[model samples]
Target: SRYPNDLARYPNARITFEHNQGIRERRKMRVNGNLLSSYQRQTVCLLGGVLQSEVSGMSLKLESPDKQVVQVIMKKPIEEPLEGLLEVVGEVTAKLAVVCHGYVLFPPGMSQNFDMETYNRLVELMNERKEHYPTMASC
Candidate 1:
């Protein structure tokens, strides 16, 4: 499939494919060093819980630990029946950027935070709530 031109509005931008069956994603852009060095991948890991919530329910509300500094509530994608996993990821990332006002944080120690526990938890959670995921119109 051809890449979407709308993504070209941002330089160095690449399409990220969030496969429905797994956490691994195929990135459209080339990168040096370990691919895991990429910020997008790390962001995806950190937001696993939040994303799961969105997929499981009508909306997700994120807040800081203290419930003061940060608070973001996101409704499920208005564009229902996403084309596929690619579209699902693209829309999720776009909405996340908006919620963060485009200034995302990547703590130095966070990349490896997508440990087995977190991954397994996400899988379990998503599986438990599979029926709530948006319907896919077509692949």
Candidate 2:
């Protein structure tokens, strides 16, 4: 992309802090070198556990331990359906599911980012407490 006409150019003048320190460059590097390759596929990771607690609109990423791409969300996409999520646990063959507010549970091995153990545990905990029927939705 060419520089916008609105940007003023001064010969031998220092650019703003963004250009001087290469913050954008570094951020791009971090995204490409570390997060973009595997886990997140260069996208942001969103954790289910974090989304479950909110009562309002929000956005977050669920990143792996190694900066792998996982999941990204600009806002809470759906409502969490808290059901007998624990009953499914211990069933290794049982498909892993992702529950979102205003959404339904999604089978595992489908989503790029999420922690199995943590998510499962959280499901079990939330299932025990949630009473309202969540609207069916998917990842």
Candidate 3:
């Protein structure tokens, strides 16, 4: 299911568990072709992890095959938070193909806010429709 040959310019765009998870949430309709993104109806779908506060340099930009841009900007990159984000994306890719990848679009250091209640609520919202996942066993 991995389209390794896709040449879409995506910085921090990794089709890892993070990106795949998001893909899972999309709705698969065998239409004649892909949908078009109009300039007025622009929305950036996010499917990636968050960065830690200490790390600098973060960004993510996705251009559609037709050149429509969808970007998700974040600060730093945190593994656990990203793990959580991808899990949510995976659970919902069936209906939303827009959620492509995740990245940071800020300068210097920015707060992760993983501990913030508001952010946690958003994560919860994403994972709300998500299927429960069992923790992987360590070898």
Query: Against the true structure, what is every candidate's RMSD?
Result: 16.6, 20.2, 16.1
Q: State TM-scores per candidate.
A: 0.20, 0.21, 0.24
lDDT of 3 at 91: 14
Q: Is candidate 2 or 3 superior in TM-score?
A: 3
Compared with the true structure, model 2 gives a TM-score of 0.21
Q: lDDT score, residue 88, model 2?
A: 9
Error of 1 at 16 (Å): 6.1
Best prediction by TM-score: 3
Give lDDT for model 2. Answer: 0.25
User: After TM-score superposition, what is the CA distance of residue 3 in candidate 1 from its true location, in Å?
Assistant: 13
Model 2: lDDT of residue 56? 44
* lDDT for each candidate structure: 0.28, 0.25, 0.29
lDDT of 2 by residue, 1-139 (tens): 1221322231221111212322222211111113233322221112232223233433222332333333322223324432211110010111122121222123332233435556545434443554542311111
**lDDT score of residue 43 within candidate 2:** 18
Report residue 75 deviation for candidate 1 (angstroms): 35
lDDT of 1: 0.28
Error of 2 at 9 (Å): 58
Alpha-carbon error at 132 in model 1, in Å?
2.3
Model 3 per-residue lDDT tens digits across residues 1-35: 23323313323333333433533444322110023
